[model samples]
Target: MLSTKTLFARTVQTTARRALGTTTTRGKHTVPDLDYDYNELEPVISAKIMQLHHDKHHATYVANLNVAEEKLHEAQAKGDVAAQVALQPAINFNGGGHVNHTIFWKNLIGEKNGGGQLHDGVLKSAIENKYGSLDKLQQVVNGKTAGIFGSGWGWLTVNPSGQLDVVTTANQDMPSNIGHIPLLGVDAWEHAYYLDYNNVKADYFKNIWRVINWKDVARRYDEAMSKF
Candidate 1:
């Protein structure tokens, strides 16, 4: 039988390969199928919200990214510097949207599953070292994420110093856009939890921890630290 670490290592390998587009076809970006059903993350995240967030919102980002990339290709071919410059925002917004959601899905699990559990591992140790305990870090992240005045994402990222940090990015901006490797991310946009939590963003932030896939996070942390 595989050890827990080995199994998680395999999961990380598969997830990383897919996220990097190594296993996907070139050209267009695509919406990935969740490992479980949309209803799997229930109570913490409703099926209606997941359905709309993934199938609708995320899918739209993928479509828009493909469109932007296609137009970008045309602009580059024609040496249209002005057009290319104008298209940068679209590419970044939609591309970041696609990237962010991809990580976001991998960051969650069903409540009955691994979600909400921060098992003993490198990630736990790192979190403890950074913020004293898992609970403390979660509070910090939730507070900062809740404080965002507009749509954005809250991320637990591996910083350049090989340390963990909780950071918030406005809009669809990715952590990688600023040289951080996002291990876990929570979408703070209204569409993510408005149907269930309404305008109470704090409740959504607090409840989201119940579905966090800490195994995926630890695996990601392991990989990121390996580079240091």
Candidate 2:
């Protein structure tokens, strides 16, 4: 017969295994399947680029995240807080890469079905109130994204007060770290568009609008607004 304390310890260990993504030693983090085919966002984004970005770059992030977590767990078991702290950057980088790319894939679609338009709604009003107009918001977002010195992201996020704001993060740092709720995030890492747009990041930024999924953005905005 097990003591109450023993049962509690077993339950905690089980939950920890699930949270660390190591329930099965042989298991690896899997790349999420896109809702649409690679070519589905054609014209706005190339199929070749999409395939490489999703299957290669984003897959690498997921793999690295799993590795980082494993290392962090080892450090924790040894009671080495310094080693655990050192692992923070790797965990943030890979974890953020996974999160940002996941949202990026969903926020894009073919333009034929009115994918990019921000119809009049709560989201539109919020944007207009914050940045004057959608075009203005795009200008700010594009400028911020292009200005990133290296790999990073530009985002339109909602603050706790429910006000829309444009912000940027260096490397893979997420908006949540800066006290903002990200509504839409644009990956500024060269790998995101170098194959298609080459050194012309501005061109890529400008063209991204054609595939922007306003519906998804609106949904995120609505949810964030509710939290305020």
Candidate 3:
């Protein structure tokens, strides 16, 4: 019973209010809180490693990302193309670091929790269809992850054709950069294992499966599939 012009004005006002709320609430990114304590993933991943990785390393990335974005905003406002170009590497490195670590935290759990348990669902079915079985999929992913020459990540992602695939990226790079939606990823950086595994990256890769949260991976898979 309202005039179309009045309806349009009300909708615009509502949208503007939402946009303002988002802008105020999302002023900057911060390190996300983990669902479990640092000591929870012990024997496989030590409490010391978790503390350094999350509180120190991941925190550094979040801070750097905010600084880089602030610089980018200033450069853009000033129409400084050269400054913007110079900031690209920092933005990419810190941005990818932030995004990767955010996903990484949710991808782990204590054994008592859902870790190591691949539920019977679409995600498991897709893996079996592509790699024959969950064991084979892990073996393949682990093998490729070990083959990385340096710091990187190993990912299970949905490719352009909507099929599941295993992939790797070097040094803070991500599956998103290569046009895939990562369902789950393992950090291949030495910092993730050096204190506990001590130069045994292969063993780290082998043991990481024990703490993988496949339920979270399945949820990510379902969300990614819905888009297609």
Candidate 4:
């Protein structure tokens, strides 16, 4: 058998190689491609708005997330807790942006499909149980979205107890971090609807429902239920 010291040296070298490989593998983050084309949800969301939101706004978030992660790694390597804490906001903002947009893109569907209808299932039951009916849930969510003073998100979330809720967060804060699993999220930022709806955010919220991918929301509800 090899001497203990020699074996330890070899193990250290192997670990170093793995670490170096991981560092070298870090690469530019790419924007996720949409499953549907712009204009696919026309009449609810305009093609021009979709293109700009995905190509310009969401891309910026992905790029910034990469930069923030790199800075976080640098701070961690230096053992600088203060620097790490200072970078937390950058991490949260960009990370939340990246995450929320990723879900938002998939949560929409083409008008050709039965986009907004929620058929009978766990999702329907959950909504009925929590809000008395789907209409009530929508009313609460829309009202909350309208009440937001500035850019933020309105969400339907499932708590650990399997109860559904409507909650709004300022800016890009995610509901998951606060112990709720997001079932559906509506982006209320001016950029999300300004091109099509202008200053009428409530109108946008109400109209956008026509293209909501209830299939995705149902799947999320099912998955959340399974985890319990």
- On lDDT, the leading prediction is 1
Please provide, for model 3 over 132-161, each residue's C-alpha lDDT reduced to its tens digit, 9 standing for 90 to 100: 998999999999998899889999999988
Candidate 1 TM-score, C-alpha based? 0.88
Give candidate 1 misplaced runs (Cα > 4 Å).
1-26
lDDT-wise, the better of 3 and 4 is 3
Scored by CA lDDT, what does every candidate get? 0.83, 0.80, 0.82, 0.79
How close is every model to the real structure, measured as TM-score?
Answer: 0.88, 0.86, 0.88, 0.86
Off by over 4 Å in 2: 1-29
Per-prediction backbone clash count: 0, 0, 0, 0
Q: Mind giving the per-residue lDDT tens digits that candidate 2 earns over 147-212?
A: 888889999999767789888999877787777888888889888888888898898899898888
Cα lDDT for residue 138, candidate 2: 97
* Candidate achieving higher lDDT, 2 or 4: 2
Clashing pairs in 3: none
Sorted by lDDT (best first), the order is 1, 3, 2, 4
Best TM-score among the predictions, by candidate number:
1
| Consecutive 10-residue window with the lowest summed lDDT within model 2 | 18-27
- What are the per-residue Cα lDDT tens digits for candidate 4 across 54-74? 999999987886786677567
